[model samples]
Target: MKSPSRTILIGGTLSAALTAPVVAAAAPATMDVTITIPQLKVAEYHRPYVAIWVEKAGTPPKTVAVWYDDDMQKNEGTKWLRDVRQWWRASGRTMKFPANGISGATRAPGAQKISFSRAQLGATAAGEYTLVIEAAREVGGRELLRIPFSWPAKAGAGGRAAGKTELGAVTIAFR
Candidate 1:
């Protein structure tokens, strides 16, 4: 037979162990996103600089990814990033370049798929949030698009938005 204190402790531990999975199951959901950058037929065509981020109500925007001209010298690419006006004003000014897992070289005009685990999003609490995508090009145009969705999104929930000039199609799905 166990001492009363030991028995109580074991019971409490067992209870916590059983509840662990339940708590994890209730954690924030993950997202899969695809950003399409359309190729334009222009003499001065330049790959557009793009930024993707998430914003929760009453919270500052958090960058998910940024695509820029990483080939430039002396981190010159970062200077053009601010052309993405909204993202620049929101979180770009203070951020260092090449943010791990959140910055990449510009992609060719096509579908670029990206996945965001709960941890990548900072695991926002159960609530509504907005996904914002902005695009700008040197000697070109600029555009911004936004998609709103709820947190802990139901399986198979997804959305897409289109841009007029600098950007193309933006799609997001939660799982």
Candidate 2:
């Protein structure tokens, strides 16, 4: 038979085991973004430069991704980032080109996906936030779409927005 002290120790260990999952379940959620670049019927089609970011009221926008021509000499690619006007004005100009972990090459005409953990997004506050995706192509039109969502996401929470020009259907899903 086990002593009283031994029984209490076993009970304590079982209690901690039971609570471990609950703590793990409460960890921050991840946000997955799917950007669709529609196939345009044009004589000269250039993959659009894209910027993805999140914005909250009275707070600076948090840029999640910037897709541009990183192959240019002397980082000349950054010069054209201004074409994505809204993002350039809001966050791009102030940032260094080829931002680590946030910069990548332009994508082809298809669905491109990027995922962000709650920490990567820097969205610590729990409230309403908007996901903004802006795309611009050389000699082509520019388009921007915004999808609103909440932090510490609700069950089955997500949003989608469709663009008519340089972009297609953009979606945001919380996991």
Candidate 3:
């Protein structure tokens, strides 16, 4: 037989051990993503709508972020977002408009930084994944860029990809 105090201590320790994994999984680290949209010399140039997402083997792509014209009247701006063909077919059409944390106005020609936590990524398991960025402009061409990296990334792990006309440079860094 055990003393009442000893029994209480043992029960508390067991409870902590059982809940440790759940707590750890819920705690997510930060990932920084930088996207650069180049200023093109053209007859008419419009800010490009961009979509960023992550894809893993045998799984459908998951949207991490999307940039489009959020200032249009009556939310009509979203109608043209389908021009980002790949993202639209993959995961865009199914989602409701103006998604929190994932939707924003189109950015100007420059590097834009966005951050995401593991919880925001939605069940990001440790494995290989691809970061895909696609951009389409009004009266301009479309471009898609992809960078592959591992999840639960190691220190000093990062990669960059560039597009010829629409996109400038895209980079991902894990701390």
Candidate 4:
């Protein structure tokens, strides 16, 4: 004796499955930032305190990096963070010192690079934004540069700006 073969029809279920639009997973958002601390010839040269951030119209700024004197006794380094005036007034005053991942020791005069992932950027809306880099040094002039870019950035999309006194070339790229 042999068993009879049975066939089952999924009907609408099968049709719906085939008709549903396929959504590909979105690629993770990533960004690379570079800034230059031009070596200066002056009577007194102090490492510039630097701050990098992004801002959209009508929203608070999001700070990406802050480089300052982190080795001072009694955490005195934090006191001077305000010297980077634009950043201090925009977002720095509300933040605590030594913020993890965002705070680091000042870099040497050259191109300094840092990268950020979606998580590091927090909840960012898809729209226009400006990358702001500000640098201030003791007994030295202050400089600030801004570069405009779009969020959910297109691959290889980037922008650059040059500073005159305290800072040098500043660039930002999305990947």
User: On a 0 to 100 scale, what is the lDDT of residue 36 in model 1?
Assistant: 87
Compute the lDDT for candidate 1: 0.77
lDDT (Cα atoms) of all candidates against the true structure: 0.77, 0.81, 0.79, 0.77
Model 3 over residues 52-132: C-alpha lDDT tens digits?
988888887889889998889999999898999999999999998888657888999999987655444542688888889
Give candidate 1's TM-score. 0.82
**Candidate 4 lDDT, tens digit per residue, 52-73?**
8888888889997898998899
- How well is each residue in 1-175 modelled by candidate 1, as lDDT tens digits? 1144235435544554577857545542457788888889998888889898889878778998788987688989888888889999999987998775678888888898776755456544777888888999889988899988776676664788998777778888865
**Whole-structure CA lDDT of model 2:** 0.81
Clashing pairs in 2: none
Candidate 4 ranges with C-alpha deviation above 4 Å: 1-28
lDDT for predicted candidate 4 compared with the true structure: 0.77
* Tens digit of per-residue lDDT, candidate 2, span 1-175: 1244235435544554577856435543567788899998999988999999889999989888899999899999888999999999998888988887688889998888777766557677888988899999999999999999888784344899999988999888876
Best by TM-score: 2
Better of 3 and 4 by lDDT: 3
Alpha-carbon TM-score of each model against the true structure: 0.82, 0.84, 0.81, 0.81
Judge candidate 1 at residue 160 and give its lDDT. 86
What residue runs in model 2 are displaced by over 4 Å at the alpha carbon? 1-23, 26-28, 155-157
Error of 3 at 75 (Å): 0.6
Best by lDDT: 2
